[model samples]
Target: MTTDRVNGIARAWWKEAVAYQIYPRSFMDGNGDGIGDLAGITARLDHLSDLGVDVIWLSPHYDSPDRDNGYDIRDYRAVSEKFGSMEEFDALLAGLHARGMKLLVDLVVNHTSDQHAWFAESRASRDAQKRDWYIWADPAPGGGPPNDWPSFFSTPAWSWDEATGQYYLHLFAPEQPDLNWENPAVRGAVWDLMRFWLDKGVDGFRMDVIPFISKTPGFPPIPEGGTPQKHYAEGPHLHDYLREMRTEVLSQYDVMTVGEGNGLDQAQMRRMVDARRGELDMIFQFDVVEFDRGEGGWPRDWTLPEFKAIFARQAASMDAHGWTTVYLANHDTTRPVSRYGDDAPGWRVPSAKALMTLLLTQVGTPFLYQGDEIGMTNFPFTAIAQFDDIAVRNAWARAQKAGTADEAQFLARLNRTSRDHTRTPMQWDGGPGAGFTSGQPWLVINPNAEAVNVAADRADPKGIYDWTRAMIALRHAEPALVYGGYRDLAPNHPALFAYAREIGEGGLCVVLNMAREPQRFALPRAAEPVMASGADLEGREIRLDGWGACICRWS
Candidate 1:
């Protein structure tokens, strides 16, 4: 009975699947070397399987200098020694497959670590055959970077290469040199690397900042004060390159591909993932989650009405058969409980469950970030010295240099909103180092691990971890939740975000209170309760506690 309905959307295995994002360095340290590794992950596959996620979206574990915590890739085909060796990676993959889970490796082709062989050869000499593999240009007049365009750190996006007497482009950190996609050599190299992984029996690829691969030819400069992203994000050859990729590599395998697209709107999303476009399977856009960012991308006011609008537009985009990757947190974002849900002493677990309910029941692939199931909260960072993320440090320094933000206030915000909030070592138990490791951790564990952890939560039959398992079970059983038409049931409600999902004769209504105060919401009709986050309703007139959410079906 379950397979019959699920098979409707299960035409593509990924469509009916739920993915969990794992940041290896923080998940578990198998060797007790103070960092999570492939061996560690292989040892912990039971935790993921027990939680009931279908796919594991493992972040980059490739060889690197850890400049951006694996985002800067030094070798595409080799697994980082910090994580484990090739044999250990294969063992981890085998473990996942044996447990009925798929693996989606991170694809960081936008740039390569400066130490990568390709970048090293390219930077060697202007006459070298590999010199054109990267974007290089002569220094601008007055001896400065090629453009005034900003890096993620707000500095120029180019770095000078004294050896070559030119400046090379690095849209991100200087250590991550952008690959010249226009160079067929570079494109061929990417395809070879992708095939190397695919031939190894891995399931899919999560392309990192993939949209940034193409840039305006000739590397034109942006206006002194204008937004540079618009000029560099989309290029004339992006779709063509994606089509080439499909024809060259991805088409030969039964695998999924999700690109981390930046500055993409509805049309661009459709162009990239529409089946006929022959580009990608789906994309993870930032519009919904980024609506609450304040200055310098800190957390800000997320009004209910605005959030509803953002969600409505996002859902509307999917009406065209274009798929999306639904998630509230990942390696780069803050934890959902700390970002959107109330994390007050007694409310954190319930609030996280509510968020899981909302995310899992949506009509798309769901990505569960590590530790989110047990309601992980932010770290207690009170100073800049506590941060290890390059993005946070850059932002803090920029703010400090500008004299616009107070040190204490910025530190307070970092504690609440930085990516390090989610990067803290996973709390497997209440033991030392949160049971992630007996050795020192790469990053400090969240001090609340004793109270909010998987071991403790698993012991409590009704805990959030159990609730998440039930949610995944329900989603897997219902076709309506997987491929249904979404209708906003209470669009204008200030505090209640209500919606209905329907497919054929089956349907479910989901209602969530987006505030700290309890809310009373009226049902459209008499309905049978399916599941809830905080509290159950007494009748058709349902009352929801703070940060509560529920799903129901019409009788």
Candidate 2:
């Protein structure tokens, strides 16, 4: 650990890094197999280097049944055959290290595919040697599922196994069975998997659904108004297991670990990622992300106050005790331009640029998802059948059965809420298949790619790519953006969002007009214009253009 201690706590490399998230299957396809492989990823090192990212956080590419993409891991130590061999992954790692960037592989220890050897042997019989490797329970009083707990799928969390006369717990799809982390043997096996990857020169891990690793004793039923996710999130032994992991495997490496902390609150987040806890370096919280999730987890409109409130809570991480991750989009989220910004033809460029300005200037490691640099929008999926995400499919089916909404309403909602929105092929150019694959892509390419693609904006000075590059460079040069004090300038202005970051003698003030009409924000003092998304600035007040954002420096 090259950490500098101050009263014992120290600064870590991850706090100063920007992670570029890549969904392996949709990044690039080098083998012409139509699915993206390690070779394809290796060939794109130049792109990442040009973007000036500090780390490449790749989603899971482990062997699986494709039920939950690669999240349902069949083998933690081995890369999927579809992605390529271990040799290709090694080459990819070397390529990343060669460019002065770290590689963080997905650590999906929370669960494994039902076809995994451990689960197969455990389900064979009640007295099997590995019978406790997964959570299994007998039927409830009515000879049905063990409890009223719901799966991410519409069915019960427990799937009955006739061979064993018991039901196994699957928090997600039936193919993904939750691992019994209470077992010391299971914890040891997980450490082995972590060691396997770490020994191969991989830098770190992005723990998938990490909080779900532990569970409450006695498979409990969901209360009348309670959600099933709470039943497993932040379970009793979660911290104990994480600390064990830290001591056994993580402490041995000079690597960073960030947990996918969905459904976790501010206090829970602090507990999970506290530097002194020996658990994780940081975590990804879903506070602001959930603002748009309405009833039944569908998309809904959000007011500016709600957005500000979420950030205020998230910015609480900037305190001496914690740190947070700032991002607008990822593989599971809709594109920033389409989801958060105005992606209409005329306002697309500035709106995307403005969002980039907001995210990068915040007090956290900026997470840039693939295609975010060039301002990619969501794929306009026409029908539900074209969608392949199991979660989305299950939700739509459940909604249909409950008559919550009709077919048309559900499809419209699915178009906005589906994970498939972000899984489309990358638009390299305005060509067939967006130059993503020579053959057919596993998913549909966004129809708007011809107009909004990397090749189009790579050289344009006013393009989203150039804007992001310039801003990232500014962040590298400015200490205020890295470890500075945060304070909001405009707390309640509906259309205007403004904040300030104070360093020793200088401060960075960011102002934005979220509405379409022009707006003006009164600055605290006269400052020099550092950067602006929608131009037009003068003295103590700057008139922002529609969806415009400006950054100013004062000393």
Candidate 3:
């Protein structure tokens, strides 16, 4: 394909697009029910479109029991009554499509709620037709779980079911039973579900925890105190499963399909997304996002080099391959400004914009979490009782049990890094409920709503929101940015981070100052300033003030 044709195909209107992620229950509520609904999302489609988002990736709002915050899906074909009805969902889709925007719904097929019909039927009797739909095995001779695999949420991966007299496999919470992807019938059923949604006009799917779908057979136990994930995660047949999914469902449509490949490395990722691979359109790699959790997981201390190294490696790996999806904040993470940038007074906006510069200039499709453009910071919760996220609550309890720290201190850390940070109500304005809803919000709105909101920032010419819009526009206007290869420019510069994206004679250099003091750097003679996060640059040497970023055209 020619470059133009490839751009046309890969861009998919949705590819050149910016996608905003909405955590439904916390986005906005139209009915004063303390829960955000499809109607609320429909009502705000205009706001998203106005913000230049070409697609909206709503986190799961399917019929779920909320065990893992809607990730434990009970019905793939139906909308959760708590979120709204199918009719409401249809309206939301219609609204988005009408506004020339696409919608990427969450596809959580790796697991299902324990109450799902298939699971219920499968657990009812060994002779049930769907008995093989979910992974189930007899307990050990001593009557315990079949394996020593630990759940992602810190419990046994296998849960005993008294009614079934067998232990069901759950990679996450006990309430979420993993589907048996090894069974052709199960894969067929899930593919059917995918087609059903595609038929309904969903632009694409953000396949959830897709890497965990296929597990090693035989239900072998992990060696004591070992990471069983190495054995069970991204198992032998994961690529087979994805390829089958592509052949059966994804290939049939001209839509985007990004897999949430939690543990995939560069080689596996290339196989999963390369055009010849026929597996997925793209994959969301966590090498960059996982830095916040640090070495020991979740609460380990981190620094600038640690964060930069991960992102740099991830970016290089993606460029080495065909494509990758990039993101700073998502429903699973805290806001980037709070976690990565200096969120104090005057520093927050520039720091947020610098992060944006870093991501948008990299080689990948950039995903912007809702409210991230406005520099939304993390919310503070004094007590565990205030947190609505199941993962945070579970981690807090685990930390306390491990005697990691006192309740107050642990809860503070939870508040800082919890997924709840992204789940908080969107800050639209300083008005009622941060202009998100007319009534009470499902979760606490960030207290800095007045300082960080769409309305206030949109009015400020130099605000982070406008800077984000400019950054996106720059990417759209420059093919070198969207399609070119990436190279880190000043890899070891103490306070300066720089990279170049080049395509033939077209290319651009992106320079960002990570420090808060003014610094000057020598640039190539061909470099000419095209845009800057703040201030202006000239000649071979340019000075950047505190968290500043500049994009220069190289001809």
Best by TM-score: 2
Tell me how candidate 1 scores on lDDT.
Answer: 0.85
lDDT of 3 by residue, 442-545 (tens): 78888889778988999999888788888887888887777776677777677788778887656898888887988787876567888887545777777789
Top-down TM-score ranking: 2, 1, 3
Q: lDDT of each model, Cα atoms only?
A: 0.85, 0.84, 0.81
Across 1-555, the per-residue lDDT of candidate 2 in tens digits comes to 555743223566787788899999999999877898899999989988998888999999888888889989897878899999988998999999999999999988778999899998999899999999999988888788877787777777889899989999888889999999999999999999889989998889988888888888886666777766565689898899999999999999898888887767778888987767888878887876668998878788888877877777787754565677888788787888888788888888888888888888887788999998998887777777788888777777787788774767777887777788889888888988787888889988888988888889896888999888888888887777877877888778888889987775577898888879999887878889988877567878888999898989884
Off by over 4 Å in 2: 5-9, 399-405
**How many clashes does each candidate structure show, in the order listed?**
0, 0, 0
Q: Quickly count the clashes in candidate 1.
A: 0
Clashing residue pairs in candidate 2, if any?
A: none
Which residue window of length 10 is worst by lDDT in model 3?
A: 1-10
TM-scores for the candidates: 0.96, 0.97, 0.94
Q: Relative to the unseen true structure, what is the Cα RMSD of model 3?
A: 2.3
The root-mean-square deviation over C-alpha atoms between each candidate and the true structure, in angstroms, is 2.3, 1.8, 2.3
